[model samples]
Each structure stands twice: as structure tokens, then as C-alpha cells.
Target: MVTGTLDRKQERIIAGIPPVSDFSGIYFYTINNKSNHELVMLLDSIIGLNDSVLSDWLNITPRTYRNYKQNTDVVLKGNVKEHIVLLLSLYKHGVEVFGNTADFEHWLTEKNRLLDNEAPYSFLTTVSGIKFIDNRLTALEYGENV
Candidate 1:
């Protein structure tokens, strides 16, 4: 869960409509049939990733990715849903650490020597990669430089 005054763009990264009164409230990452738009927004708008790249990450064809965008009622399941959840979790942690979205995005794209000179964002295409990045984020959250 996360708490913050998210703008419209930030809202796109979330799985559901946040509480109106408490702008800064915890957000749980649970995507379902109804939240397909959110996933699309996260990948296209927030992450600035193209459909082809996103499709590749999800191990789906570009045509399927297009279908997902065109069909509002499309429901994501299995590994694709799991991967989106992982990405949202990583973004949440990055925001917490950087205190802003831009800085976090920069950090994500910047090569890190600790990660064997690979940009953190480059490791987001696999489950193992997600775990590795999450571990690094946790370490940073706990004041570990690495």
C-alpha cells in the first residue's frame, strides 16, 4: 500500500481509484478484469514504453498487446498480471526512495555498477530480474548503498 497525492498520471499507475478524501493513502497492487486500463496506462503512459517492448516483456505478440489496448474489458491473468504487479511495486519503492517520479525514472535508466553495469529498468523483463531489482530497492530503503 502507498499514500500520496497522486496526479492524474500517477493515478494511471494504480490498480484502482484511490480514496477521494485521503489523497495520500495506501494503494494495493491487485489487477483484475476491471483494471486492464490501468495496466495499459502504466506501461504506455507512466513507463513511456512502446507496445512492442511491453509485449516482448510480457512474452506476448504485438497484436495481442494491441488488442489489450483496444479492448477495455480485457482481463490480464497469469504471468502478465504478475509482471505488471511487480513493476508497480518497483515504481512505488522507487518513488519512496527518490521522493519524485522523475528522479526515480532517471535512476531506473541509469546504469548501476552494483548491478553489473546494467540499468535497473533493463532487468524488468523476467521474474528473476524483478526479484533482483526488488532486493536492490529493499537494500536502498534500509540505508544500504548497494
Candidate 2:
């Protein structure tokens, strides 16, 4: 597997998240109850990565990389920021993973194993663990207020 280096800040971010992806109640447990730190732990778990791989990705020392992660917990939890960081983590390793990316729907449709017509809705909803867009959802054009 390919490994990279990270500055201290990046290392801290990866070190922050827990490594579990099977939890069905990740969001409800974190957001509704303000357990953002718990979510940070989960993001850190992605691909079982380390500071070295991340350092190379960031082109900095491990120290700086880790510091950013320690502070980026909240943004990581909201799926607003730190996504590229997360993606870079996986991408550098040649691993495929998912987040709240805008391409989520399309990616799920084409690659994610569908449970036989139970989807375009339920599957994604379940995978995302969010109930915002019910059954009647459609992909919006770019910048169309998704």
C-alpha cells in the first residue's frame, strides 16, 4: 500500500477519529446529543491511515498536520470542511470511500452495490444514515441548491 507523510496538524486529525464504519447510529448519536468528538474519531478511522502517509499528502511535517486535525473536529463532523482532507487520506492510499460528497448519489448508483431496486432512495438514505431527502429526491444540477 502507498504511504504518505503529514505535518503535525494533519496527523492530529487522523489520530482524532475512531476507526469504526459499521455503526448505524453515528449521526444520531453525535449531532442530536452534541457528541461531535465521537464523530471525529470515526473519520480518523478511515483506511487505518497514519501521519506519514498524510505528511506526504500535505507536504509538511507531521506536527503541523496533526494540529489542524485536532481543531478540525467540528468541521469534519458537519461534513462541511475537512472533506478534501478525508478524500486525500483515502486517495493517497488508492482506497475508495464515501462522505457527504455531492457526487454521492451518482457514485452510489453506478458503483455501490444496490440491494435490487430498493434504492436511488432507501439504500443511499441508509448508507448516509440521514433521513433528510425522502423517496421523491432527484439530483439537482450543479449549484441548484441541493
Candidate 3:
């Protein structure tokens, strides 16, 4: 449901992805695909996050990520893979709710009154935090005050 324009590569990467609400589907994808650095970088680019932020979110050092990127055979741990899947799903949902990637990125970087003046980007490191952000987006979409 991404309303924002995506490049052909991004579209192909996201093609056939299920909605975020489909936890089981995402879980299956994560388990079966066993994420590599290439996929992580693709999702990070689509979400407009830099390598530093993505490394922090994944709890991996930048050097480690670079090494992984260089070694195509290297697959991330299951937890990291799951987290990446959740992040991409959240990014898609955010774009759909905000009508475009730029607006969603702005919302993510800005401090929110509902979050006690914390930017939404601060919460991307954890799955529960991502869900909280998702709930906030849903509230806005439904015209409910959070």
C-alpha cells in the first residue's frame, strides 16, 4: 500500500510482500530467506535510513556490516532477520498512512507530542517500539487522537 513512488529496484524488492499485520507470513519469509546484507541494504535504502542507523538498529557494528556485505555467504542471525522484516513492513505501512515516503520520513524524524517529545526514529531499534509507532500511525489514519 505504498503511495510513494519507488524505483524499479525497490518495487521489485518489495513485490509480493504481505501486509505488516500478517506476522506469520513475515515470520515465514524471514525463516526461509535467511537475510543477507544485500537485502538489509535494500530495505534500509527504501526506508531512507543510512548504514550507521541500520547498524545501530541491528545491534551490529558498521565494520561487521561491511564485512557481511563483502561476504555474500554471510547470513544474519534469525533475530536480526526478523527485525529487518518488521522494519520493512513498518516502512511500507508508514508510507501508506502518510501518503508518501517524504512525509513519512519527516514524521519519523520529528519529535512527537504523543511520544513525550521523542522522534519516532528513536523507537526503530525494537520490535515493540515499531509496533507502538504503527499503532500511532493507525490512530492518525483513523482520525483518533493518541
- The model with the greatest TM-score is 3
Mark the regions of model 2 whose C-alpha exceeds 4 Å error after superposition.
1-43, 72-146
lDDT of 2 by residue, 11-124 (tens): 554444322232333333333434344333433444344665444333446675466457645433344223333332322222222233334434333432333444332332
What is the per-residue lDDT of model 1 for residues 1-146, given as tens digits with 9 covering 90 to 100?
23345466556556353321222332233433346655665555555557776777677898988887788887887568667666666666666777766787788788989888988878888867866777787788899875
State the displacement of the C-alpha of residue 144, model 1, in Å, after optimal TM-score superposition: 2.2
| Every model's TM-score | 0.70, 0.26, 0.84
* Candidate 3 lDDT: 0.76
Better of 1 and 2 by TM-score: 1
The order by descending lDDT is: 3, 1, 2
**Best by lDDT, which number?**
3
Candidate 1 vs 2: which has more lDDT:
1
Preferred candidate (lDDT higher): 2 or 3: 3
Per-residue lDDT tens digits for candidate 3, residues 45-143, read: 676667787778777887876676678677788888777777888888888888888899899999988889999989988878877888888888899
